[model samples]
Target: MDITAVNALPYEDFVNIFGNVVEKCPIITAAVWSRRPFVSLNALEAAISEFIDDLPESGKEGILRCHPDLAGRDLHSGTLTRESREEQARAGMDALSSGEASRMSRLNEEYKTRFGFPFVICARMNDKANILRQLTERCGNERAVERERGIEEVKKICRLRLQGLVLCDAPNKL
Candidate 1:
């Protein structure tokens, strides 16, 4: 779809389509819709960034909490949302061996216990080995550092997702 179409979308329709760009945070999309007549994809992305950056500490944590753990129960039970499932699959998380799966579960639980939110990474940009490595390494980070890392990953995910919905470089975009 074109940026023009995206700009013209009804609030409900816009939310329905782009709602999960930030994992389960549709409210971001809803809020960003108010900044419409976006000049380009970059403008829309910047709007999302501004909203997220303005969030209080608790709100940032809330966004991280909305993400399902990678290769977690949701993935095994087929309960992940379509976008999440596909992203996890891209990281080969959908086919983890029993040992690998169990290890992931244990580490995920540990990470959540420490951080009050699940570990999150741009799975589309990483394979299982890299994700596992990141999960372990990030667990050692300070709370503030980790929170910013997770939020940055969320932004990367959102950028890719938005790229899929609207033309990235279309001129005269609404």
Candidate 2:
């Protein structure tokens, strides 16, 4: 939406337009359109970056929930964007070996049991084997460490996604 149009929107409407991500991730959603207009895309990005930077460690999990579980073959909801799906398909993970498939299932169960959530990664650029390998290793980390690592990884992925969608002039960094 244009800045003028965005500025005119009510607070509730503004939050709704952003897909309710603000409730769960205030850092990424801190930009209030009514108070100020971002002069350029970079300005908008800078606002988002500042918010993400200021978020407390405890708030990271809430933000992570805003991302979809990577290669979540059975997922029917959440932010599994079409572009992410296509990228996984290209990386040859839309199909899985029987062993790899079984491993993913088991890992999913173990991961959920430990974390109370499915393992989430931005699997845009990783191939099947590499993704599986990483998942296997991550499954063994202590809960606190894994949680921190997961948030950092998700932030990296989000930056890459924004680079692709919002920052056309810049190269994708992740």
Candidate 3:
């Protein structure tokens, strides 16, 4: 839909439209719905970011934990959202050889064990090898640092999803 159409959607409709942008974090989209009539994709993204920034540590952790492991259980069980499935497939995750899939599964477990949440990344922005490399390297990061990085990656994913759903435009003059 275009920016104007997006701006005109009702509260629940708006929230539903964007609810999956950050995986299972519908609360973030619900919060953003109150700041409606977004004139540009950036405005919508900023509102979402502000809501996330204001969340308590527990709330942030809940959002992080909502994300699925890369090429993990959801993919095999066909439980991933259509957007997520497409994004992972684009990253060559769907075509992983047995060895690659096994390694990814191992890294996913290690990363989650270390960070207490799934390792989040903008899959559409990286190929499988690059994602695996980063996953391996990031597994060594401090928990706080990894948490922040995951949030940033979530933002990038949200931005790309929003761009797919809304057209960019200059802010409306009051």
Residue 7, candidate 3: alpha-carbon lDDT: 83
What lDDT does the true structure give each of the candidates?
Answer: 0.91, 0.59, 0.86
Q: How close is candidate 3 to the true structure, as a TM-score?
A: 0.92
Query: Which pairs of residues collide in model 1?
Result: none
TM-score of 2: 0.65
Tens digits of per-residue lDDT for model 3 on 19-101? 88888888789878888888877788999988888888777778889888889999989998888899999999888999999
- Runs in model 1 lying further than 4 Å from the true structure: 168-174
Backbone clashes in candidate 1 total: 0
How would you encode candidate 2's per-residue C-alpha lDDT over 82-146 as one tens digit per residue?
55565556766567777776787788778878875557665665777787788888888887787
Give me the runs in candidate 3 sitting further than 4 Å from their true place. 168-174
lDDT of 1 by residue, 1-174 (tens): 777788899999999989999988999999999999898788999999999999999999999999999998898799998999999998999899999898898899989999999899999999999998888898889889999999999999999888866655663443
TM-score of every prediction relative to native: 0.94, 0.65, 0.92
lDDT of 3: 0.86
In model 3, the clashing pairs are: none
Q: Against the true structure, whose TM-score is highest?
A: 1
Error of 3 at 163 (Å): 0.6
Clashing pairs in 2: none
